[model samples]
Target: MEPGVPDDSENLSDSDIRLETVIQQARLAAGIDGQNYRRRFGSTLETDFGSALLRCEEEGLLEAIPGGAGWRPTSRGFRLNNRIGLLLLEHRSSGPDMDRSNAHGMAES
Candidate 1:
């Protein structure tokens, strides 16, 4: 894999996937309320998933409104999530073990 890239076998849990889905949905919907997202995802908004979304915002993947408000995905965030989806798909296709070395061409460089 690329030096820092996570292996496909390192799959996100259902909760994580749900969080990502919520983020994407929020993006599609323009913005999303934290409470509403929490409800939809069947988890508290203060858990690791919520924290991850905040981290995404800090990393420029999304933008959070002020006053503890809602969030919107940035162009970069949208693109990243798309890429993540593809990677996940590839991982699934490769089976649970997921040959990351081949998938990432780590042997080439």
Candidate 2:
């Protein structure tokens, strides 16, 4: 519910369905390429990304679309993502300023 975070919009429309398809393709490619990369470079990751996603699904954080296009985040997943966003925002705000640029003449004033 934060300014930039999307809420529990789980009901998938036509556009959402298309997005799901794209997500599925991207995940598939990442899984394949990621496994190959691990084997070639000896990644320390024990479980694969795909398996992690499957575990998430099993935990009710996501559910596969009816036509198998891809998965959509459940309400719990939405809450988790929102909380993560909030944490990231808080962390950034609490950290030392990374941008060295002092624009708008405020640093001089």
Candidate 3:
């Protein structure tokens, strides 16, 4: 495995990767589609970010940062974020202990 890279990365759902990226980006700035993310990951990643953001928003897990074109986790989002982080860690460390299905049915880099 590539150090720090999830061992079962190939098996990770696009939603998982997208949400992770958004969370990481939010830490750096406070948004889902920051310039750096767009530059490094390309526009294709934006679609994933959009869908992920919408899903979280719908789930009451994320909300816009007042007047900014950014998002922040709601209290509910924060609680679920920890659960997600742990699930991801479990997948990474255990290496395919559970089956993960991609609803999109298409693999994205």
Candidate 4:
């Protein structure tokens, strides 16, 4: 119902959720803007920033600030993002591409 928010009828993929998680991490590290996100990740934005922010909020990983103009990471969000980052790092170091074994149920053999 909110402007820029994605429709709930559409299903978000795993990559979408992953990107949203990382967005929260980026927001915590830099700020909630495309430029900072692209700078931190070294890639152009692949997901809609507003939708990702909404997903993070729905997942309890982020909270809108008092003025509703920005967000801050929740304690749980910090832990979740750190864990995901470490997992991604480990996955990348293990191989050129993530497979079923390394990604922990992400792929099929």
For every model in order, what is the number of clashing pairs?
0, 0, 0, 0
Error of 4 at 15 (Å): 16
**Candidate 3 — which residues are off by over 4 angstroms?**
1-20, 23-33, 44-46, 66-68, 82-109
Q: Could you arrange the candidates by TM-score from highest to lowest?
A: 1, 3, 4, 2
Q: Candidate 1, clashing residue pairs?
A: none
For candidate 3, write residues 26-109 as lDDT tens digits.
433344544445465553332444444545666776666542335666777666775434433443444322221122331224
Q: Model 2 misses residue 4 by how many Å? A: 24
lDDT of 4 at 5: 86
Evaluation by TM-score, superior candidate among 2 and 4: 4
- Deviation (Å) of 24 in candidate 2: 13
For model 2, residues 1-109, the per-residue Cα lDDT tens digits are: 6997887667865433432433343333222232333344343112212333344556665555443223456677565644323332343345433331122111211
Ranking by lDDT: 1, 3, 4, 2
Name model 4 segments beyond 4 Å from true: 1-48, 82-109
Q: Candidate 4: how large is its RMSD?
A: 16.1
TM-score of each: 0.44, 0.31, 0.43, 0.36
Question: 2 or 3, which is superior by TM-score?
Answer: 3
Q: After superposition, how far is residue 74 of candidate 3 from its true place, in Å?
A: 1.2
TM-score preference between candidates 1 and 3, better one: 1
Q: List, residue by residue over 5-99, the lDDT tens digit for candidate 1.
A: 76766678875675466545654637556556556665433342344444555667666655444566678867676643444344334444322
The digit string of per-residue lDDT tens for model 4 on 5-94 reads: 876776776455545655555537433444454455543232323434445556666655442324556777676765434443443344
lDDT to native, each model: 0.51, 0.38, 0.49, 0.46
On lDDT, the candidate that comes out on top is: 1
